[model samples]
Target: MGKLGKRTVAAREAFAGKENLTVEEAVSLIKASANAKFDETLEIAMNLGVDPRHADQMVRGVVGLPNGTGKDVRVAVFARGPKADEATAAGADVVGAEDLMEIVQGGKIDFDRCIATPDMMPVVGRLGKVLGPRNLMPNPKVGTVTMDVAEAVKAAKGGEVQFKVEKAGVIHAGIGKISFDDKKLVENVRAFVNAVSKARPSGSKGAYLKKISLSSTMGPGVSINVDNAVAE
Candidate 1:
């Protein structure tokens, strides 16, 4: 295809054969494909009739993607002491409980995520109405609720990265941006996979990491096969 023709072409290509593509091919495909797109995603279909549900359990931690999830994470860091000052200095959209409630009531601050020091947790409880239904309230399962102000602030400004086993038992997540180099995206994905695989609940049955896939912002998700995700 000519340059313009290829440019207009959909980037999606099926993962053919049992053989895995080289790193070069993988990265080139992700970067070149302009057809990438996203939908409100859900569980990964790993196999026929084997919809897995233990993905959330294998979560390592939710990280703030430095540039956001290609979108802004209206972070509300809850704190009211020395930690409060710390959070503000770190560039958090800092809020004390009183201010937090007012913001919520005004419907002005639609926070994408909430990070709080242990000191702020008690007060955060008061705003359950404002945060819970939206899934904006951070949970310990993903390490958003913490005593460390520095970590909280950093993670808050960071992207809201979550890991979970989709129905296919495949771990799915958005690692980084399409503008990011393939190696970096691969690295990010690799790191995430490692963390999640390590955190696999001991209670889980059978082998973990049924498969893997990587895609871009507006393109179809092309899979990264997992012959042995644990091995690497």
Candidate 2:
């Protein structure tokens, strides 16, 4: 059997016997254990109690992390005329109409967040098969499809994060980087939890938030108390 490295052993020792800790404690533990050469992203995963197969039970929404995600979000906008200019002026990395569609159709999608004007949906809809699977489809519910291109671009470039529950009823996203201070990380974590709590679908019954876990890019995950995570 291959022996565990010293860093792994130390990380496990630090996390020993620590289960279901408060949000703050879990963040601190995760940050401390992140000793990788690259800046580690602090990720949060929440197990929810809803089957997304049913339309009404789907859990998906956007939240502006109080302390930014500590990562640059690439934004692409589908618009024309003044709206396209507005997007470019607002710092959209890529902006176009059918041209953007062609780029995506050629399998050269390079942006993270995608936005679209209401009129551009006809063109954007054609790429649903490609973008939908990547969670980059523009939807009004998530503020990615609207006439206000500038604000949307700013929000995307800012700390706004969109989360959608997976097949296993789990929602996961990186809240921030380990380089972030403790206060910022805690604030971002709480903001995310509160957003998910508020997005609770009516179809969901008991225990909407079943479990919450925190971990760095290269470290082991540590479970956090659901109650503590939901507390304002």
Best by TM-score: 2
lDDT of 2 by residue, 12-75 (tens): 9999999999989998888888999999999999999999999989999999999899998999
lDDT of 2: 0.95
Q: Candidate 1 residues 1-232, lDDT tens each?
A: 5463443343423333413444345556666654434432211212211244544344334544434444445567777778777777877765666677667667765566687777667777777787776666667787777767667666655655765454444555565666665555555555555666556665566665655555554545555555432234
What lDDT score belongs to each candidate, Candidate 1 first? 0.56, 0.95
TM-score of each candidate structure, all chains considered together: 0.71, 0.98
In Å, residue 81's CA in model 1 sits off its true spot by 2.8
Candidate 2: misplaced stretches above 4 Å?
none
Minimum summed lDDT over a 10-residue window in model 1 is located at 40-49
CA RMSD of all predictions: 5.7, 0.9
For model 2, what is the alpha-carbon lDDT of residue 5?
A: 96
